[model samples]
Target: MASKKHNDHYTDYFGITDKKVPFEDLDVHNDTRLFLDPHLVRLRTSPRPYWDQAVKCLDTFLETLTVRVLSRNEDPGDLLKHIQEPPETHLGMARHGYRGHAASDVIAQRIWESLTTDLYSLFRVGLLEHIEDLPLFVRGIDRDITSDITTRVFFDSLAQFTMSCMRQIPELSSRGTIQIEKTVWDPSHKQWAQRTYTVPKNNDGSGIILIPRGWVRKRLLGSASRFLQTETLTYIQHSRAQYDHRGKLVTPSKKTLRKELAKEPHQANIFYTEAAKRNRQNLIAQFWQYVDERYTEKGPNLGDGLARP
Candidate 1:
């Protein structure tokens, strides 16, 4: 009872290829043998997490397209009618063995047109609303993956696709030239203040300095524990070797250091030294300050009355 043409269109849109290999027969390491292109085959065993995230971004973009652009009357099943219909290349050709390369190209082009139009509209809305939509946009791109290609190869193709589309947007292309200043906590003043350096609009380099809170805690605690262990070992060893050339103990301070090290590392008189506490507090304060500066919305600054007389 289903229309054959409709079925074909759905299959093509979803990229349901004729390859009959069952899931049980598929193996990640052996996937190289599945593709026709040698370059694509090489990506069979490539890092998956990175590609998975990339695919997720693509998926998100497609989801946005479906939700924001598609009409209520149309379903994904109607994709064939929307796509630029490909020409019939081979007469009397069996559909199973013959790869519709030209048809694939047409489908890809139409999808790109749809994606670019929707993405540009989304960008315009975000600009007008003064909203930070880059994260959501990136997530949108990561959400739509209906491909059978290997993770690495798929991401490589996706990167090229995204780059091609983004190159057409002038605003996004000029993003690298724009810079904004971020505020930070000034330890000396004990108040929030603007940073001297301006960061790029894209904020690509911020990752190097903006460490996660959990990572900071782990690193700080780990370093403190290691330092305590080393100092404790050093004090115990020094106490035994503190005797003078005449075999009489001259440095009586070793006993005091040993007693101090014997207390719990977090105790006020022991490992919780003033320097250590100050360093920890500074790290925490800086992290919170960074969060406030990056996430908090500041009131608009009204320009000082006309011009000074």
Candidate 2:
């Protein structure tokens, strides 16, 4: 009786009531042919709602991951502690220099390590949670299927689908060696440091390194001693002007003029202007360093032209 019912289900699925109607004789090209098999028609239409639910589930999962994993604030000092000391002074207080923070080498290593660890943790947790919640998100599917088995099947199907999509883009499908450059802040000298890695397409995921923008900025600013020096000088000169020499203001001394030119407002303005210019130059140099590291291919020389806008 069980065998008879199973055979009947197969017959209904193929839309063949009479065994005498050979499967090869059916007109496969006919538009009406697809509707003949109720199972085929249902399979084609059912995936839309399931896919919609899956996307919603993915969005919710990402939101949770961003809040819980990516946005967790860690102490700068603690993160810096993992940095390894470098052999020589590579960073400093000048333009494109690493400001003298705790130490450049140590800070750079720490930033790399902390970000990589955080990203790995995020990926692991996010994937696991998404798979675990699949049953809840995907509806009107086989309820008897185990979550573990379903998750595997879903991922396998997704991987196959992704590969098929990627085939349309030749650039993505091509296999080649790629170089990845990473910019790290060196604290000992206030500057950016770059490291490059060559990764083969086969071993691509193993070479992935994640660095947070906030972490990089924090290190860059932390090592920025040159800015501090300029600010200090400006503050000192301004403060000196506030003090009166007895009742009347004292004449500009040679030492004062040479050091800061604080006595004359015109000279003071010039000094501030020069300092501001230097700071801007330094920032521009830093920006160029990043540009060079990321976009290695030679192109038009924009140079100081970019400073205009």
lDDT of 1: 0.27
Q: Which run of 10 residues does model 1 get worst, by summed lDDT?
A: 207-216
Off by over 4 Å in 2: 1-78, 81-173, 176-226, 242-309
lDDT (10s digit) by residue, model 2, range 52-133 = 3333433443344334445554433322332321201111122221111233444434433433342334333342233222
**Candidate 1: segments with Cα more than 4 A from true spot:** 1-174, 177-181, 187-190, 195-198, 203-222, 239-309
TM-score of 1: 0.19
Best by TM-score: 2
Cα distance off (Å), candidate 2, residue 219: 13
Best by lDDT: 2
Model 1 error, position 59 (Å): 48
Tell how far residue 139 is off in model 1, in angstroms. Answer: 36
